[model samples]
Target: MKSWTLTAKLYVSGLTFLVLALTSIGTTLWVTWNLEGGAAAVNEAGRMRMQTYRLALAASTSGPSGETLALIRSFDASVALLRSGDPSRPLFVPWSEDSRQRFRQIAETWRQLRAQWTADRPTAQDAARDAGRFVALIDGFVAAIEAQMSRSTTLLQGVQLAMMGLAIAGVVAMLYAGYLFVLNPLARLKRGLTSVQRGDLSTRVEVDTLDEFGQLSAGFNEMAQTLQSLYGSLEDKVREKTARLEVKRQRLADLYEASAFLAKAPSLDALARGFAVQVRRIAKADAAAVRWSDEGNQRYLLLAADGLPAALLQSEACLDTGMCLCGQRRAEASIRTIPIVPDPAVSMGNCQRAGFRTLISVPVKLHDRVLGEVDLFFREPVALDDEDRDLLDTLATHLASAMESLRAAALERETAVAQERALLAQELHDSIAQSLAFLKIQVQLLRDAMRREDAAAMNGIIGELEAGVRESYADVRELLVHFRTRTNEEDIEPALRTTLSKFEHQTGMKVRLEIEGHGVPLAPDVQVQVLHIIQEALSNVRKHAGAREVVLRVSRTPHWRFEVRDDGLGFDAAVGHADETHVGLRIMQERAQRIAAVVRVDSSPGRGCAVTLDLPAAAALEPAAPALGALA
Candidate 1:
């Protein structure tokens, strides 16, 4: 009736059924005992009547014999037991007043019959009549017990019917209670669980009672709410991660494209313009400009500009004086954002007039040295965050590196041109110029001989002049061949072989070229100069040494050494002469010195000639020699 736990309800129901079963058992046992008691009394009364008849017959027939006397005693004991009211023994009977009167009459008849058998030995007719009356009374007593047993049987049937009705009613009540308190709520909970299993987190058990089911329902609802909240938060986190991945992917693509563009740009201006365009696209800015320091002129120069108005582009105040917004910000040596305000000192009035609202300046730095600044302009007042600033800073760094590379390339080109011109001038002065001067002197001699009217001298002088002219023409052709020779192969061995083959073919002399340390590489400029020096040595051997055989040996150990040995009619080195041969020797020495190499001439008048050039390993690998100033 009141709210209780499931355990308490079950305990109470079990106890009630136990009590009802015990009551039914007790009632059935009591009714059965009363019925058995009435039947036993009837049986006792019938046995007593039969014993009294037998005693009467024996007395009438045998004239009070011993058998008759024993029968009388036995009969008397049975009647006394029937009349006793002892409740302990089953044979004892409790009788009403009418049954007691009937039992007394039977008892008195048995006594008269026993007295007649013992004292007078009555006639057979009297004895028979006495027996008849006793038998009739016994029958009446049995009839009374039978009637009482009938009443007990009817009461037992009534008790059994009442127990059956109570058992049926209890069963019905138990089933109904179970349905209301247990089965119905269990079904509801089962349905709610099914819904939740199907992903319906909104489903909740609606049981509202102060019981176990109520507490279970509340806990289930709390769990569902927690799950829903967690699911929502997980979705938010996934979306945030997806967005971040997309942004990182886009940034990677932009960096890749920027690196490709910057690498191929040919000059500083082109690199700057390309870099500005890429940065503007990456940062989503309106305009971009690059300005670099002109240390030579002590001013900053605008290298390139993109998407800026013509009026602002034409303004030379920023270029002439380092008073512009980017120039002022370059001193900070970091990326910064500035508002484009009308300030004369800052020189941003042109930017303001051009409708630019904000400026993001990124200093182009190389190893902590600020070379320039890249300026990004925006129409709206924009605040540049760290990510935006970092992007611009990276672009500026790449731009700075490209600019440095271009500068180095331009410097190398100019140095190469100057060196070539100096080499050409020295070659002309040493060979062709001297030969032309000698030819002029020979012509002067021929004119003098002709004026003196000596035909033999004039003819000899003409022969000398023709020889000089031929020698000069040969020198010019040799110079042309040397200058036209270019080493296009990646390795120097091929070029060396080509030069050796040409020398062998032109001079009609056997030239032996032996190379050691075959794979050792020399710098491009070093290889070129060494080859030219070798050519010069070979030429000297051909023109002056008058040698039949020459050996050109290029060996590399700790350093490189170029040797040209000739078994020629050698010249004396101690006696110096201002001749074409000495001039050729001087040109060879100068070529060797250009690469920081040392040259040695081992020769005598008639023995042989051995010219060797030894180069340091470092100078061969990296030819950082200064320009030749004045070669004597």
Candidate 2:
């Protein structure tokens, strides 16, 4: 390519300016010659003819009427040049010869009229009357001619001045064009070329013209363009390398996030799931799966996976571990292969057939032992790079550590549960079993005393036997319900109602049982405890109070509320404590406490007694379950 300098283009533009200046000067001279000569001739003719016509009119005015009229008309013919009138209308300005001749006739007639009036006026008195009218008419004609002459003079002067101005403007425009198109463009090109020569290959020239100058400018532009393109390509390569570095940095960041997540995972399943999720995001894989060795088995179990078919994940021998498979095939395998199902809706490659395709299974090896393997797949086959393999290996190590800790925790929880069950067994045998045995012995003693009939001896024995029997009964009932040898499963409401009704049947006392809401299922231990409480309350009513009717109302919300009201000879409950006679009351209070319920008694000397029990519904249903109470 050729280069153009500022001096070469500026010299060409200077010649172009000189030619334009000369042409403008020649044009101005030609226009001046035509306008000045033509306008002068017209003005001279108008002046001469106007003076001649005025003199001729004056000369004919003093002759005889007919002869004077003839003289006025003949000499006034110069007024035939008075062409246009009413100048504002389109056809009013009479420029044609025929129209001018018609106007001459009008001027001639005016002159003849003046000659006749002058001839008829033989005296000064008559002449004076018409003189004023004749003078006024002549004055109007002269004024009209003068005004037309002035307009012609102004128009010619304007034309001459416009020609000169145009010539000057043309010269100035040529000089400006030389600077804008040639000089400025060349100057820019010179600086740009210098920059390019100094190793700034990105510099470029700006040229927009259409002559020889423009052609040279275009050549310089092309040269700069070639250098710019060469350098731009090199810069693009650097940017590509920088972008790859950024991608590697992002991968390192993802690894740290995965490490933090693994540290917090509490179980083997959670750790495996977290590893698979991170792998899915980093690789942009369609699905990810993890398989680990089961604790006591040689076979691999699928621990976790995303977007894998449930049937294939659960099926035996679905994934291959690289070592055994590589040995069998006589190949040094880096990753094992399996069919991984991609979600049809989410997979980008929807044009392919619907099913599993290729999978890349990389083993998670911790030290010398193979803990598990991770499988990643795409809708289309993906070729793994060395970086991908290494990153996966790091993730696998972290996941293995997390899984080992989780396994140890599971074993610890199992041991704790076993110890708790053992302690519960010991408590039930030591306390409840012994109390039930003592109750059975005392019941036999009471029966034996009743059989041997001796009057005073019988009376004292009956009192002793009744007190002993009451105490033994309270102990035995509490043991069976709360500290049970063998727990029984019974619904809470039916058991409670049946126990109260049985006491009424035994003593021939009227008892009313009312239940509200619907019956719910209860655990056996909870039901037994609640039933014994009701039994104890009823026994207290029979033993101490000489009341007739009793009402047992059972209400259930999220918890149970049992109320036992007896119309018995009530005692002041606050001032007294449970003795051998009131041992049943003490048993009822103890049973309510064991079940995490509240028991209150309302009694007075002359009023009836009402015992109320409010237990959490879960406690009234299951001994071990946590209670969900009502909102209020």
lDDT of 2 by residue, 103-148 (tens): 4544665556555554553344444444444444445444443454
- Tens digits of per-residue lDDT for model 1 on 383-475? 876776677777778888888888877887778678778878889988988888888888888888888999999888888888888788878
Q: Which segments of candidate 1 are over 4 A away from where they belong? A: 1-230, 296-300, 316-334, 341-349, 365-370, 443-459, 514-519, 553-562, 571-578, 593-608, 612-632
The TM-score of predicted model 1 comes to 0.58
Candidate 1's error at 532, in angstroms? 1.5
The runs of at least 3 residues in candidate 2 whose Cα sits more than 4 Å from the true structure, single-residue gaps closed, are 1-499, 502-508, 514-535, 539-548, 553-562, 567-572, 575-597, 603-608, 614-632
How far does residue 414 in candidate 2 sit from its true spot (Å)? Answer: 10
Q: How many clashes does each candidate structure show, in the order listed?
A: 0, 3
Maximum-lDDT candidate: 1
Colliding pairs, model 2 = 489-524, 523-621, 547-568
